[model samples]
Target chain A: MSETAQRGGAIPPNSATPLVSLRDIRLTFGSHQALRGVDLDVMPGECLALLGDNAAGKSTLSKVISGTYIPDSGTITVQGEEVRFTGPNDARSRNIEMVFQDLALCDHIDVVGNLFLGRELNKGPFLDQKAMLARAQEMLEALEIRIPRLTARVEKLSGGQRQAIAIARAASFQPKVLIMDEPTSALAVAEVEAVLSLINRVKAKGVGVVLITHRLQDVFRVCDRAAIMYEGTKVAERMIADTNLEEIVNLITGGH
Target chain B: MANYTERAKQSHAVEWLNDNAQVLSIALFFIACMGFFWALTDTFMTTGNLLNVVRQGAPVLIVAVAMTFVIMTAGIDLAVGSIVALINALAAILMANGFDWVTTSVMMLAAGAVVGLAQGWFISFQGIAAFIVTLAGMSILRGIALYITEGYSIPIKDQAGFFWLGRGTLAGIPVPAILAVLVAIIGFIIMRNTRYGRQVVAVGSNLEAARRVGMPARWIVCSVYMMSGIACAIAGLLIAARLGSGSSNAAVGFEMQVIAAVVLGGTSLMGGRGSILGTALGALTILIIGNGLILMHVSPFLTQIVTGVIILLAVWMNTRLFGAGFKLGKKG
Candidate 1:
């Protein structure tokens, strides 16, 4: 791990603390334990790839971080300060934004509407459409995203366009920590490239990123550190340069 | 490098047509209905007959405007007709007991909102399906009206101010029609331009998505029902003022007519898509068909059959013919 740590470019410097640290997080549902005693740390300007096979508790752990699940026992420290989140909103108030696997977009609304969603710009009692449109344009432009029609409803957009909008919405919120679950699962090759570049851009801003995906290639392309989970517990944490794809695959398939 | 095809850019006129296909189809259908009626009967084209149609259609138009919001949220309020009857009966009873029209009207409107809020609570907070909750409301509300009035039509007498609301003309236009128009205009602006309107559409489009985004999804869902209730109250008041009587039987089958108008106006029953302009045109269409059939000496009972068939036909055309890829053959 120490040998490959040097190759993990953009890793947070020693002076910077971990953006989020989790200790002994445990969660259960009826007879099943979704997460059991998981510990993890994410540093600023680093991309952490969460890897596991089906039913490996990867989603459960992400939900715990995103405040969709209340762990039975855990201490979550953000910027070295311990805190508890009651719901997703609480997590959001702390500038932790999650791009859900399903994208969580309103299809009937236009692109600007989806981007703004709950936080609409208002003038008096009405929505400031012009201001919102201008800001939405700026947001996409800043991210190097091209959406021809900002007023077009999201339902009409292609899969890649939809994913881009979802990421842009999360990225534009000034999030200190960004979590994405399988964001490029349904994208074409070029679209996947777009998203990978987007992740790099976000990471460049010193934001901690947690990417949960099944695509190992994506992990190699962007993630600096990889965590592998087995059953309901994390089994291995490896610096991306320290571990080969075979080693990570073995960790996921229980061969290690 | 992946060869990505540039997205096809549609001309502004084509984009506008695509966005408003449902509304345009309904508009064309409305115009066709008007032209057919005018060709059939000279009386149908007369200003007096048109004004009468507006007056008679005013109550349905008011309720239908509110129903557009309810339907846009992918929810239905079947109890609106029952609520109207209840308010109609309650208003007469209040006035008969020496309560002035102003006090009685205010009380009825409040009653309507309370009833709507109660039903909304069950549907939103309690996780009950809107259809089932409002179905129960339909029966219970109408039953309450019948029980209170005992199947009698209570007379409302000698309130000139109140009578003006239903019977008086403003610049030769019926007051009820004017009120309905104002309500429609307000509904149109709110749905098209306001933050609350956008929230309502967001909630309807995807409830879970709206909630995850921090919208007060439950509150938005509940408030639309309250709006429907208020509209029903206004409608009931208009009916009472027009007939000078209130009865449990008032506006029977009104929910069906209102829903038909909304659906015919291109509002989707599945939620997330609706148009207030389409709803107004739809209400006018129904009223015109009924009036024209009568003018052409069609049987009164046959009018119901025709209206029902037209609603079905109009919705069928909306979903099948004019839904998508519909073009006028000539490009702008």
Candidate 2:
């Protein structure tokens, strides 16, 4: 194993600055307080597992970081620079990418089209389909994902393949911070292994990864630190070496 | 360890057929309609009569092309027929007041864009349903047309050049027919090859997904309405040029015909799946039925009933037979 892997997916010891830091993030929708004054930090090359039960604000917190939601009150600092995001585009410009739990793919479009999505290659006014198809193959190949057809509509692909495409799209963009919400929730055992390894591959590049998952085994396998949320607030934070599945479950279930 | 079995690979021909099933079905229907008409009426197969059908079908074909874009986004512009009538009246009025045909035509197209943009703004930015907004537009526009002309058919004398656009033939082809063909070719190219076309499909397939990816989703939605408006303007001008007059009554129930053509061509009203070629075939099919029925001495009143039934049947076949999961043979 490499030195970083030996350290349980932590950033190299010499690096002190975090890739992203969220302080006192709060959000409300109508009468419901989805998140309340949550503070978190993700260091470069570290995989942070965010754990929570239902309605524990896991998805909300990640959305705030990804700019899907602007926190009602919070300060987000990226690489020691404070920033405010008006929308997902603002966050994307800063190399922040999110793999949405719903996959957020256009079903009518083919695989190559979805892989490029908003950033399509065009020869003047026309789409450069040939170039895009070639690049899509390379993108999937680099991830070791084998999709039988690139021109097939995304709706026709299996669940694992769809999830793989979503991850491939975000990872290919060289994001500084990657947020994945329940990426393995719907995958089979083999697909989960593929995704876990893919996450490791992305982490090896020094990108800060925040994985929101209910799967405790995934946290133990890949995370350096685990933060547990209960009822819209962070209950506890533990380094992977200092935590166990039973202790994390206690934290999530509101037990001491 | 879990084993993953690859999905069986389909042959190239089968895959192509599956992908193009909707368009292919519509193509076959169009040919069947032509064959049926040719057998029933000797004149229907003649060159001159066929040219006449193309000329008459030109306006519907032009608008149907634009409607393909609108329907692709899961939107409908019910006001299109009314907009055509309004522009038809406005063009004649402008020309009567000493405005040249060229300037009048340009101004009419601009007016169409303005009208479309207004409705698009309401639907896209203000969060109104496209059906409701365009429905209201339909009533308001036609009411304006009726109020302006006061039920009069205003004649446009002189301007042989303007009349040429409606009546003139190029190499024995009617000008309007030629214009409609050009629009279809352009629409096909745009839908198949352009970035804007991809954006349209993406937005239609999943609006939230398109927005999350930073596409100008609202703007794309609005632009399609503008395209519909431009097409209506062209259709209106063609009518006025051909008739040498304009009336508030022009293109009555025209939206039904255009929408019917689009849906019949296999463009899904649900949006995201459509073909301009399918729309062209659908329009031609409708025109052939109308012209052939008349030649067969069928009552003009019964023609409406037949057209409605055919539309229902075509759309039924489109959804039930040619829809997703439809296979050509036992292998599928």
Candidate 3:
């Protein structure tokens, strides 16, 4: 009876289908295939964790979704319309921003400058410093980032502060779906907590998040659903309540 | 608690000292040189000698300004000396061929810009190292200069304004000095105020990060080399006017002097950090040394060794002062 009800529960509230739906995605780099027939559905406002071991297709999927790579043969539909990304800039223009593993920040630039880098606030030809700073301050306050100086160079910032700024930059763009690849992997324990809070804040703002991480604790704590990829294929998709850490690890490491 | 506060105070003082070390070291060097000159010669401090220093240092200073940008990107342009010779020959050749002075001057400047762009494109876009490309450029440009004039010095006639640039003084300031100062001011403004300037610094610091952020790194690199070429051409024309003769041998070994001035000014050859004011001061320092040596009747042969030693010391001081501020490959 529970199984029947589980299958009949309005298909987990994807009433308008997924904001991003990837079907049978494949990626090959030279002799190695990074991703193979990977299918994913990310509904709006939900945090989905893509968990996998080293060399898994988690990074490739994130890259493809972020428009860094073109899948060899696949159908990616955004809001029920088939979409193909030519590059990262194209993906960003489509309101799909990815927080790369390296964060891709210009350290010499200040927090406000980094936040509004390529897409700066401008009044005609001049950069609108007042408006851009105000917007950056708002994003920081909303995320609860306790930076001592917003004008300080990113190079002088603490690790946590840098991470917060990176997230804020992506968040300020207000993408429909934010893809964060190992956002907290290099962060300390306190930094991790701050990042978790920031992610929740983004999710609350109605932006779907695809968190690609190796840590199981983050997956269970922050994510609604878990998708485990092994080798090049995603082998399992489970609700947070229905799975345990050990089982997920087994699925990632083993074929069955 | 008192110990912690005292330690903190000591560290803060040290940091302050480190930050101001560049200016402080230069001041000390300046004072010491002045004292030595006063002891050795009476004419060294005169206005006439000062004017002489300015006249002699102007061309080198102009070339050094452009060199600062190239060195700031951790790149080198070995073809600069040869390019200067080529420009000198071209200016004279155009004048001899019945071209008007204005058109000939414009043509020479354009030639420099084109040559710079060509070399820059090869280095920045073709994925070739700067040293290799500029090395080849140096030989190629020297060959072109030789081929054009057949190793002969040609006197530039019918171009009085061009001649005046090297020999004329304007309101107590020499023309070349004025030109150098103006170029330095423009360089300072661009590096400090403009977005494109910041991108150049960023690319020098890290190309991968710059590219990821959509900076036109190749363009910036290319533009810098082009500017360097234009500078060399200007300096070449100055040398030609000063001698009233354009030759393939004019401005020979000038690249070394330009690099020396930049390094003395605290502009590291490793790139990502430079200051135009520092470069100007560095050029002045070179002029002072050259003048002081001449007043003391030091042989030109020994002066080269002394200059080399002084440059090394200046770079050592720069490293000691700015070592903590710049991080090398800390990202990876």
Taken over the whole model, the C-alpha lDDT of each candidate is 0.91, 0.91, 0.80
Give me the runs in candidate 2 sitting further than 4 Å from their true place.
A1-16, B1-4, B329-332
**Candidate 3: tens digits of C-alpha lDDT, residues A1-256:** 4432322122244466788988788899999999877778888888999888889888889989988889999889888889888877777877888888888776656678788766656565445778878988888887777676666568767677788888888887778999999999998887888898888889988898999998889888889888888888877788888888888888778845
**lDDT per residue, candidate 1, A93-134, as tens digits?**
888999999999988899999999999999999899999999
TM-score of each: 0.96, 0.95, 0.88
lDDT of 3 by residue, B181-256 (tens): 8888888876655666667667776676666556778898999999999998888888887778889887788888
Tens digit of lDDT per residue, candidate 2, span A1-256?
A: 6532322243233457888888778899999999877878888898999999989999999999999899999899998999999989989998999999999999889999999999999998899999999999999888777889899999878888899899999988889999999999999888888789888888999989999999999999999989888888877788899878899888789786
lDDT of 2 at A234: 79
Residue-level error in angstroms, candidate 3, position B325:
5.4
Point out the higher-scoring one by DockQ: 1 or 3. Answer: 1
TM-score of 1: 0.96
In candidate 1, what are the lDDT values of residues B216-302, reduced to their tens digit?
Answer: 999999999999999999999999999998999999999998999999999988888889999999999888998999999999999
The TM-score that candidate 2 achieves is 0.95
Cα lDDT over the full model 1: 0.91
Candidate 2 residues B234-290, lDDT tens each? Answer: 999999999999999999999999999999999888888889999999999888988
Higher DockQ: candidate 2 or 3? 2
Is 1 or 3 the stronger prediction by TM-score? 1
Return model 2's CA RMSD, one decimal: 4.0
